[model samples]
Structure formats: C-alpha cells, structure tokens
Target: MRIVSGGIQHETNTFSHQPTTLADFERDSGCGPDFSGGQAVFDRYRNTGTIHGGYIDAADVLEFDLIPLICAKAQPSGVVESTAFDTILNLFLDRLSETPAVDGVLLDLHGAMVTAACDDGEAPFMEAVRERVGPDIPIIATLDLHANITQRMADACDVIIGFDTYPHVDMRARGREAGELLVRMIRGEVQPVQAYRQLPLLTMPPMQCTLREPMQSLMQNVFRMEDEPGVLTATVAMGFPFADISAAGVSCLVTTNNDAALAEKKVEELAGWLWDLRDELQPQLTPIDEMIEFAATHDGPIVYADGSDNPGGGAPCDGTVVLRALIEAKFQNAVVGILHDPETAALAHQAGVGATIEARVGGKTDDRHGTPIELPAYVRALCDGHFVHHGPMNQGVVGEFGPMALLLVGGVEVVVSSNRKQLLDREMLRVIGVTPEHRRLIVVKSAVHFRADFGECATHILDADTPGIHRPDYANYDYQNLRRPIYPLDNVTVDFGG
Candidate 1:
C-alpha cells in the first residue's frame, strides 16, 4: 500500500493593505527542498529521537513514505498574489505527479486562504488534486483549529481533521492520527464517511481559545465521539474570521463510517449547541492603555499583544495604533518586536548598529488603522533576522530575520524586520541581539499563540485593541461573500449540522 503527503497553508486577512508575495515567504522562511512542509507543517511532526517534538515526531512513528511536498505558509495576511499562488500550488502539484500514485493523501491546509483574483482558492487546488487521484482513493487533511472550511474543500476530501485544542498541542498527534487513519483505509479496515456544519457567527482569535468554556465544551464533545463505534474521528473548527469568504465563520465536522446520516445528525446537534452558546464565546479582552500602564508598573519580562495588528491573522503587522497608544501613555521599559518596516530595516542595516538613524515607522501599510510615527532612534542591535526555532510550532526550523534591526526610540525599543511574520518564539528576539530573557516588557505582533513562549516568566501577558483588518468584532467589516444571516453577524436562528 502507498500513501502521498503534502500541504499548503496561508491564513488570509481580507483587510491587510499589502499583498502577500513570494519575497515575504522567502525572507521569513527560506524557500527550499521541502516547500509545502515548512515551519507549521514540518515542526508539528518533526521528531528528534525521543517520543516527542510536537506533531512531526508522531508522524515518524507511523512511518509512511514521506513525500514532503512544497508547503508555502505565509503569515495570515492579505489576499495571496496570483503569481505567488500559482508558483507554490503548481510546485506542490508537480511533486504529487512525480511521487507516484498512492492509496491516500495527507494535506495540511489553512481553510481561510484567499487569492487576489479568487475568493475560494483551496477549492480549485483540492478539485485539481481530486481530479487526478480519483474518488476511491481516500484523502484526509488536518487544518488550523481556526480554519474556515469551505464547501469545495469538504466535497473534495474524504476527511478534514482540525486541532481539538486551540492552544493546538496536538500538531504531531493529529498528523500521526491522519496517517493511522489513512493506513486503515488502505487495508480496508475503515471506509470513512464525513459530515460538516457551518455556524453563522464569526469572532477574533483572542476570544476563540478552546481552553475556555464555550470552545472547551465544544472540544470535549469531539473527544467523546471517538469512543463511539461507527465514528472514526471528530473535529470542530472555530473557523478563521479575518478572511472574507462565503464560509468565513465557525463550523463542526464529523468523520465516520457505519451511519453517515447519524454522523451528520450528531454534527448538526453540536453546531446548534455552540450556536446557542455564541454569546459565551465573546472574549473578556483587556484595553490597550491598561496593558501599557501595567507594563510600566511591573518589574520585568512582560509580553503585550497588539492583537489587532497580528500578521498571522492577515492584519498588517505594521499597524501603529497600539504603538501610538504606548507612546501616548508614556510607558517606559517596553520593548516592541517586529514593526515590519523593511525600508527602515534596510537603512539600519546600511548604517550598521550604534548608528543613529531617524525614520518613519508603523502605520505605513494601512493608515485606516493609524498614521506612521517618525522617531529619531538609534540602532541598538542589528541582525540578519535569522534563527533556528526552539519553540513548539517551529522547532528545528531554520529561517532568516532578513535585515532586522533593534531601534531604540526614547523608552521604546522597536524591533523592525523586512519580514512580515509574528513573534512566536524567543528566537525572534534573541537572534536579533535583543535578548528575550533580558527585557522588562516585550510587545509582539501576534495573538494567542505567543502565549506558548511569552506565557512563561511573563509577569503579565495581555492584549491591545490596535486597529487592522482582523478586528475581533465580526460586524466592523463589510463581508459580501459569507452566507447571509449567520450567527453573531445577524443574530438570527438557523439549523446547523455537525
């Protein structure tokens, strides 16, 4: 029996000003032999020798012939450029063609991907791949817990599994599970039947952590289904809201066999349960000014999230709202990483460290959020912005910071980079000479995932209401594509499926 594996991941933020390009992917993460399986894909399943890592280690145990395809994952940001999309997708497809036919295919895809030209990008790719493989061959996929599962993707693949936990500790376990499930399909042990239900509500990532009550209850139900005989696996994806698509909200999926109808019924029941409890999902968020004030009063090692400007969710990481707030609040001992000013980074690299340089930073990409602030600053540290990740998501991962500089403007230390990516791990700080361990206050342009690293030793880890395309509120944006009258968007009642 043979099995094929590949992945393509991108979280599209409909409101980001910059177009996601090949250069962005290259500088942040070096484009190399394993394309589709980069930081998120490879790290999840990367195994050293122990029974551990994150997700990839478990895949090693399952022992499928790994055809590590070209995986192109950029920070969740604006619509993908057509050229960039074609390049990555075609490379992955070409690899699939050359790698030999197989019994099953494993894909790691971000459900909320949108291209500059096309709203539904995952469909065409899945349809194209399905057309080549034929129907009998099973396809099982793992998605971001926050994936916006589209109808096209649901129709093409036999199974779609999402991270049960929002903190997403199961990256390796899920991959191994998918492999085990695929092997079963090859051996004729289980023929999978699937069910999917879309919910009407859409909210931000900060409010969507599965560790909490609403999502926690939802995740527990998914686990309980595994104990049932006919059910092979159960997954509930909250769905990424930033991407403007027809299927942009929450959804629950069930992959089972004996009774497809029963499975679909179960999914519907769960979706309805979640829909009824939609108000509970809204986050108890902190104010941006309060976050700054706390950092000022606190002693050392605090991490504040400018969540609205998180590039991972497709917001222009360069938004100046929170930064401006910090400046206005007169907070000191605060260090900000990744303003994502490429021009400013270039000049700093040219001038070298210890060189005093004055430039405009932040709010450059999207003034809809805030205007740029010019700072007469000194380059405290200069780095190529390169580091091998030592974190859960991208362990053993090598990537460049690509012309990064640590700029000191009065009390604020601005970490600027040519790459538009989130500060997930300490390497983003350590690699740039700004020691992650030493700082009193660390501000990163990321959402929940930053907690994995910063959560430890952090006197306080909090969030800010900085402006960008990926605001937590669902009503702020004009979404023409999403199915009309869904959940929190309209507050209407409708039947949901599992």
Candidate 2:
C-alpha cells in the first residue's frame, strides 16, 4: 500500500508580536532547516527522534510504500502568516495530486497552530487535504501534548493521537502508533471511531509536565484506558494556553474500533477525571524575589524556571527578571542561559574570549520582559552554537543558537545567543563552556521542557513569577478571542455527570 505522509508543524502564540513568516520556516536552526518538498523529508528526518523519523522507521518495519511530501516547521512564534501557511499547504496538496494512488495519509502536526486568517489552522489544512483525498481515505495525525484540539480538526481526520508526555519525549512513539493504526485501517483490521471533548479549563506549562504529579497519574490513566477492549488509541492534550484562540484549553480524544459509544464514554470519563484534578493542574509560582531568597538559602545547583519568557511558547527569551535578581542579590555561582540578544552576542564575539567589554544584554525584544541590563562583563567563551541534545526530549537532534557567547557579569555568568531557543538541554550551556552541573544556581528560559534535562541534578526547582507573555497568571493577559467561562479566567460551574 502506498501511503502519503508529511506535515507543517508549528505551535502559534497569539500573544506574541513576532509574526511567523516563510523565511522563519526556511531558516535552519538546531531543529534543522525546513524542506520545501519531496525526498528531502525522508533524508532529513530518517533515523532522527522526530515524528517524521518515526513514520520512516515504521514504513521500513511495516513494509509499506511511504510517499514523502512537504514538511516544514518554524520556531513557536506568533500567528503564522497567511501567505506562508497557504504556500506550504498548496505545496503539500500539489504533491498529493501528483501521487498515482494513496491508501492513507499520516500528518505530523502541532495542533496549536494559528494562522493570520484562521484560528483553527490545522483544521483548515486537514480539510484541504480531505478535499483532495476524498472520504474513503484514512488520515491519521500525531500531535503535541499541548494541542488546542478543535471539532473541525476532529471531523477532518480519522484518528488524532497526541503525545502522552509533556516534555514530548513520545513523538516517535506516537508517530509509530499513527502509522501502525493507519496500516491496520488500510488492511481492514480496525474501523477507527473517534470521540473528542474540549474542556473549559486551561493548564499552565509548569503543572502540565507528565513527569510530575497529577499529570503523571493522569497519563497513567489514559494508557490504562487505551489498553481496554475496543479502544484503539487515546490522547489527553493539556492544550497550549498561550494561544489566545477559542480552543485554547484542555481536551481529550479517544478512538476505538468503530465503537462511537465506547469512544465517547472514554473521552467523557477522562475529561471528568481531568476536571476533578483542575486545582492540582493550576500552578502557583513563587515571586521572583522570594524565589531568589529561597535559592540563596538552599543548596547548590538549583534550577529556577524562567517560564514566562520561554521562547518555546513564543516569548522573546530575553527576559531579565531572574538575571537582574541574581545580580542585584549578589548571588554566587549562578548562570542564566539562552538570553536571545544578537547585539550582545555580536559584541562578545568582537571582544573575543577573555576580553572585558561593556555590553547591554537581553530585554531587547519588548518591554514586557524586563529592560536590557547594561554591564561591564568579561567574555569568557564563544561558540558556533551547534550541539546535540543529550536529554530525554529531542535526543540526537542538533540544536543551533547561531553565534553564542558566555559572559561573566559580577558573580553571575550569562549565556547569550543570537537565535531564540528555549533552554531544554545541558548541552546548550556546555556548548558555551559553562557546565550546568557545577553552577550553584541555573536559570533556564523555558517553561517545562528543561525539566527533562535539568530536573535530575537540581537540588531544588522553582518557577519564577516573572512578567511576560507566557506567564502562568491568566489574569495578566488580555485575551480577547478565547471562549469565556474558562477556569481561573472565570469561576464557572462544571457538570461532570452529563
């Protein structure tokens, strides 16, 4: 059987000012450059730890012909440009039209994508594909755990599987599952029936981590349900709350072998269970000042999560709240990573290693993430910003931060980079000659993904309540489009019995 597979994956943040352009997709970073179309998808993703890699691996084992198409992705940013979205979609569809015959399609998508013209971006993309493939063809998709699933997406695809883990280590596994299920459907082994339920609740990134409590137990329950008779697959998407769209909240999806009743029952059961654990999922962050004091008093190698300014969630990744706090409090043996400031990084490169130079770093994107702090810093090290991830998430994938520099300002060491990226690996720090394991305090500009790499050695971990776009405090955001009566945003009653 010939199966066509490819996707445009992006997690849009509606609150971000930076618009995602086609150039952004084309630019190469640590995640790799974007492919316009065809065999390049197979060439770039094969043997990697990505969804496309999983599809290729499954194709080899399952002995099915897999036709490659356009697969492009950009760093998580603002709403995708209409031109960029249309161009990529048309490219994929045109390739599909060229294929002689297709039995099924597997899409690797991040369900939170929002375009300039569409709030539910993945739905429209899937609909256009459906228009080309007709009703008989089975389309399966693998999504991030933070997908803001909509009814349009549910109706457009046969099966939608989301990652069971938050740091999203399960990408390949989920992709393999989608491929396996598609193979089953193609062979008439299973008739997939899907059920979807969107919750009125939104979860913060810090609490949505599957490695921690509440989420860990919740995912365990999802796996248990998936093993039940008649159930083909199940997903518990915590949802990307950073996207200020109507569907920006928690959702549950269940698929069974042509068992609609069973699917619906499972979805409702999981949704109700999640609703009952709402309070636990709602995160409480410590104030930056208090957190610093706590860290100073605590043991070495503490990791302070700078979530509000997470570039992964579309923040600028140049927030200075934590860095400023660390400097002002005279904290010793501290390090702050991935401050996305090209000007400062360039200045460091010009100054060369072991040179002392006066430079202003971070807070360059906007006023929301603290002002740029001016300091006479010593440029300790510089790098080309290429390193492979050694963490559980995205392991073996090379990351690039463009030109990077390590600067020492007082007792604090800062890692400045030209490209905006979340601090998800210890390799990001080590690439700049600063070992994270040796630091007394390490500040990562990430929401939760850093936990996969940094959590193990951390003496204590705390989420800083910094002011930025991705802050866990829902009230701080001026959300105009999101459906009202959502939890924390409004105190609404929930009837789980129904």
Candidate 3:
C-alpha cells in the first residue's frame, strides 16, 4: 500500500509576543536550513523518537511505501503568520496532488497550533488535505498530548491518536499506532468509528504531566481501556491553556472497530474520568525564593525547574528571576542555563575563553519574566551550540542554540546562548562543558520535559513560580478569546451522565 506522510507541527502560544514565521520553520525544523521536502523528512526523523520517526518505523516494518512530503516544524512560539501558514499548507497540498495514487495519509500535527488567520490551525490543514484527497482515502494523525482538541479536527481524520505520556516520550509509539490503524482501514480490516468530547476545563502544563499524580494513574487507566475488546485506540489531550482560543481545554477521543456505540461510551467515560480529577489537576508551584532555602540546606544535584519562562511553552528562555535569586542568595557550584541572551553570548564568544566581560544577561523578551542581570561574567567555554538529545524524549533529534558561551557569573556557571531553547536534555549542558550529575544545583528553563532526563538522578526537583506567560497558573493570563465556564477559571461543574 502507498501512504503519503508529512506535517506542519507547531504549538502556538497566543499569549506569547514572538510571532512564528517561515524563516523560523526553515532554521529550527531539525530538517536543516535548506529543508528538502522528500528525503529530508525521512533523514531527519528516520532514527529519532519523534512522530515522523514512528511513522517511518511503521512503514519499514509493515512493508508499505511511505511517500514523504513537506514536514515543517517550527519551535513553539506565538501564532503563526498568515502568509507562512498559507505557504506551508499550499506546499503540502501541491505535493499530495503530484503524488501517484495513495491508499492512506499520515500526519504529525500539534493540535494547539493557531495561525494569524484562523484560531484552529490543524482543522484548516486537515480540511485542505481531505479536500485534495477526497473522503474515501483514510487520514490518520498523531497529536501532541497538549492538543486543544476540536470537533473540526476530529471530523477531518479517521483516527487521531495523542501521545499518552507527558515529557511526551510516546511520540513514536503514537505515530506507529496511527500508521498501523491507517493501514488497517485501507485493507478493510477494521472500519474505525470515533467519538470525541471536549471538557469544560483548562489545565496548566505542570499538572498535565503524565509522570505525576492524577495524570500518572489516569493515563494508566487509558492504557487499560485501549486493551478492551473491539477498541482500536484512545487519546486524552490535556489541552494547551497557553493558546487563547475558544477550544483551549482538555478533551478525550476513542475509536472502535465499526462500533460507534462502544466508541461513544469509551469517550464519555474518559472525559468524565478526567473531569473528576479537576481539583487535583490544578498546578502546585513553588516560588524560586522559597526553593532557594530548601536548596541551601539540601545536598547536591537538586534541579530547579522554572516553568514560567520555558521556551517549550513559548515563554522567553531569558527569564532572570531564577538566576537573580541564585546570585542574591550567593549559591555556589550552581548552574543556570541555557539562558537566551544573544548579546551576552556574542560578547563572551568575542572576548575568548579566559576573558571576563561585563554584560547584562537574560530577561530581554519582556518585563513579565524579570529584568536583565548585569555582572562581570568569566567566559569559561564557547561552542557553536549544536547537540543531539540524549534523553527518552525526542532522542537523536538535533538541537541548536546558535552561538553559545558558558559564563561564570557570581561563582555560578551560566550557560547562555544566542537562540532560545528549553533545557530538556543533560547533553544541552554537557555539550557546553558542564557535567550535570556533578552540579550542586541545576537551574533549567523548562517545565516538565527536563524531568524525562534529569528526574532519575536528581535528589530533588521543584517547579519554581517565576513570572512569564507560560507560568503554571492559568489565572495569570488575561484571556481575550477563550470560551468561558471552564474549570479553575470558573466554578462550572460538569455531569458526565454516569
């Protein structure tokens, strides 16, 4: 069987000030700067643990022809520019039109994406694809765990599987599942029927983590449910609260083999189960200043996660609150990194490795994250800022931070870079000449993804309540377009029809 595969993956944070553009996709897609459409998609994801990587594995194992199209994935940022979205959609549609007859289509989509022209980005992309391919051809998609599920998105695809794990280690698993299901549909093995439910709830990233309580056990139940008779697949999208859209909330979907009643029953059960845990799903955040006291008395290898300024959630990685607090408390043998400060990094690079340069670092994006820290920084090391992920999530994927410099500021090692990237893998620090295991205290500009790599070895991990758009508390954001009567934001109760 022949299958066309590709996607435009982006998680848009409507609260973020930085607008995603075509140039951003070209530079950061992991497909390299001059991203060739066909072979480049296969090359970039063939050996990795990504959605596309999973699709490639399924294609290889199933002995099916997987035709590659354009897979454009930009870093998580604000709403995509209208022109850029159109260009990408047109490219994908053109490729689909040019390809020979295909039995099915596989998509790697970030369900939370928003474009300047539309609140629901994936719906338009899928609708466009459906229009091109016609309804008979099956389309299966894999979405991030944080997708803001919509009725339109559900209507466009035969099956939409979301990652079951937070820190999102299940991209490949879900991808493979989507591919396998699409093949089943094409072969007439299983006629998939789906049921979707959008809950009256909005959840922050910290509590949405599948590794933690409520979600941890909840996802386990989801896995158990998937094993039930006649069930094809199930997904629980915790939803991305950062995207200020009408459909920015938690949801559940279930697909069964020619069993619409079974699908509806399973979907409602999943939604009701999630809604019951609403109170427990609210984020529990510890202020950075409070964490400093605990770190002072504690032993080495404590990880402080500043979720507020996480670039993964579209917050500027340049937040100085955590760094400033560490400096004020005179914490030694601590490492604060991968901070986004192009000016500081560039100066450090120019000054060379032993030179001490006076510069201001971080907080450059906005006032909400905190002001810049001006200090004399001793340049410890410099690098080109390119490394592969050495972690469970997105393993083997190439990551770049542009020009980077390891600066010793106030006896603390600060790894600053010209570009913004969330601190997820330990290799991000190791590449810049800092060993993560030996550090006394490690400050990371990330939410939960870092836990996938650092959580195993660290003595303690605390989520710091700093100031930024990606902060754990959803109430901090001023919602202009979000649908009302959601949990935490409002006290509207839900009845699941038990």
Candidate 4:
C-alpha cells in the first residue's frame, strides 16, 4: 500500500507579540527548517527521532511506499501570518496534486495552530486535502498533547492521535502507531470510527505534565483503554491555553474499529474522568521570592522553573523577574538561563570571554516580563550554540541557540542566547561551560519540558510565578475569543451525559 505523508506544525500563542512568518519556518532549530517534496523531507528526518522519522521507520518496516511531501515546522510563536500559512498549505497541496494515487494519507499537524485568517488552521488544511483526495481515502493525523481539538478538525480526518507525554518524547512512537494503523486500514483489516469531545477546562503547563499525578494517571488509563477490545487508539489533548482562540481548551478523542458508539462512549468516559480531576490539574505556583527563600533553605541544585516566561509557549524569554529576584536576595552559586537576549549576547561576544562588560540584559521584549537590569557582568564563556539533546525528548536531534554566552552577573551565571529556546536539556548550559549539577540553583525558562532532562539531578523543583504572556495566571489575560464559561476562568458545570 502507498501512503502520502507530510506535515505543517506550529503551536501559536495569540498573546505573543512575535508574528510567525515564512522565514521562521525556514530557520534552522526546533524540528529543523522547512522542506519541500519527498526527497528533502526524507533526507532531513530519516534518522531523526521526530514524527516524520517515525513514519519513515514504519514505512520501511511495513514495506509500504511512503510519498513524502512538504514538512514544515516552526517554534511556538504568535499567530501565524496569513501569507506564511497559505504559502505552506499551497506547497503541500501542489505537491499532493502532482503525486500518484495513494492508498491513504498521514498528516503531522499541531492542532493548536492559529493564523490571521483561520483560528483552526488544521481544519482548513484537512478539509482542502479531503476535497482533493475525496472522502474514501483514509486520513490519519498526529497532534501535540497541547492541541486544542475542535469539531471541524475531528470531522475532517479519519483518525487523530496526540502525544501522551508532556516533554513529548513519544513523537516517533506515535508516528509509528499512526503509520501501522493506516497500513492496517489500507489492507482492509479494520474500519476506523472516531469520536471527539472538547472540555470546558483550561490547564496550566506545570499541572498538565504527564510526569506528574493527574496527567500521569490519565495517560495510563488511556493506554489501558487502547488495549481494550475494538479500541484502536485514545488521546487526551490538554490543550494550549496560551492561544486565545475559541477552541483553546482540553479535549478527548477515541478511535475504535468500526464502532462509533464505542468511540463516543470512550471519549465521554475519558472527558468525564479528566473533569473529575480538574482540581488536581491546577498548579499552585510559588512566588519568585518564596521560591528563592525555599531554595536557600534546601540543599544545592534546586531547579526553579520560570514557567511564566517560557519561550516554548511563545513568551519572549527575556523575563528578568526571577533573575532579578535571585540577585536581590543575594542567592549565590545560582545559574539561570537560556535567556533570549540578542543585544546582550552580542555584547558578551564582543567583550570576549573573561572580559568584564557593563550592559543591560533581558526584559527587553516588554515591561510585562520585567524591566531590563543593568549590571557589570564578566563574560565567562562563549559558543556558537550547537549541541545534541542529551535528554529523553528529541534525544538525537541537535539544537541551536544562535550565538550564546555565559555571563556572571553578580552571584548568578546566566546563559544568554540570541535565539529563544526552552532549556529542555543540560547541554544547553554545558555548551557554554556551565555545569548544572554543581550549582546551588538552576533556573530554566521553561514550563514542564525541562523535567525530561533536569528533573533527576534537582534536589528540589519549584514552578516560579513571574510575569509574562504565557503566565499561568489565566485570569490575567484579556481573552477576547475563547468559549464562555470555561473552568478556572469561570465557574462552569460539565454534562458528560450530553
């Protein structure tokens, strides 16, 4: 059987000031740059541990011809520009038109994507593809765990699967599952029936982590349900709360073998279970000062997660709230980083390693994060910012932070970077000669993804409440378009029976 495979992935934060453009997709980082046609996609993702990599492996094992098309992915950012969205979509469609007849289609999509013209971007793309391929062909798509799944997206595709892990180390595994499922369907072995249900709850990133309690137990239940008779797959997307779209909330999906009733029942069951655990999914963040004080009382190597200013969720990453607080509290032997500040990084690079320079660093994006603080910093180290991920998530993939520098600002060592990326791995600091294990405290500008790497060595892990666009204070955002009566934002009751 032949299958057409391609993807367009982006997790848009409508509150972010940075607009996602075509250049952002072409830039190297995250899942790498944009690739057009099968050869390019195959070349870049063949040996990688990405969704496409998983698809390629499955194709090799299943012995099916995988026709790859455009595969474009960008780091989480603001609303995608309409032009950029249309350009990538047109490329995928144009390539699809030129390809030969295929048994089925597999898509790698971020279900939370929002563009200027479309709030549910994946729906339009799926609808267009469905129109071209007609309704008979099987279409299966994979989504991020934070996908804000909608009815339109559900109706447009045959099957939808989302990541079960928060750090998202299961991309390859999910891709293989989708590929294997598609192969089975094409061979007339199973007929797929899917059910989608959206919940009124919006969860914070810290609480949504699969490594933690409620999500961990929830994912275990999903796995158990997947093994049940007739059930093909089950997914629970916690939803990207950073996006201010109407469908920006949690969702549950279930796919069964020609059993629509079973799918509906399973989805409703999962949703109800999640709703019951809503209180557990709300994280209690420690204030920056309290976290610092708490860390001081504890042992060395505490990990402070600055979840509010995480660049992974599309925040600027230049927030100085935690850093400033740490400095003010005279917190010694602390290393905070993966701070996105191009000007400061450039200054450090110019001063050269070991050279002391007076500069204002971080909080440059806006006042929401915090005001930039001026300090006399010694440039401890510098690098080109290239390192392989030594963590569970994207283990084999290489990451780039553009030019980076290790700055000793007072008692803290800060790793500043020109490019914005969450500190998901220790290699991000190690590349700049900062060892995390030896430090008294290490602050990562990330929500939960950092846990995949830094959680083990940390004596204590605290989610610090700071100020930024991606802050967990959901009530602070002026959400103009989200559906009414959502949980946390508003008190609401869910009727699972309906």
Candidate number with the higher TM-score (3 or 4): 3
lDDT of 2 by residue, 120-174 (tens): 9999999999999999999998888999999999999999999999788878787
TM-scores, all models, native as reference:
0.90, 0.97, 0.98, 0.97
Worst 10 residues of 3 by lDDT: 29-38
Instruction: Give the best candidate by lDDT.
Output: 3
Off by over 4 Å in 4: 28-34
lDDT score for residue 490 of model 3: 87
**lDDT for each candidate structure:** 0.73, 0.88, 0.89, 0.88
Q: Where in model 2 is the C-alpha error above 4 Å?
A: 28-34
Q: lDDT tens string, model 4, 357-462?
A: 9979898888788999899999999999988888888777767888999998778998899888899988888999988999989999999999988988998888
- Which wins on lDDT, candidate 3 or candidate 4? 3
Error (Å) of candidate 2 at residue 59 is: 1.0
Candidate 3: list runs displaced more than 4 Å: 32-34
Superposed Cα deviation of residue 427, candidate 4 (Å): 1.3
- Model 2 scores worst on lDDT over the 10 consecutive residues at 28-37
Q: Give lDDT tens digits, candidate 1, residues 73-140.
A: 67666788988878777877787777776667777676778887778777777877798788888888
Kindly give the number of clashing pairs for every candidate: 22, 2, 0, 0
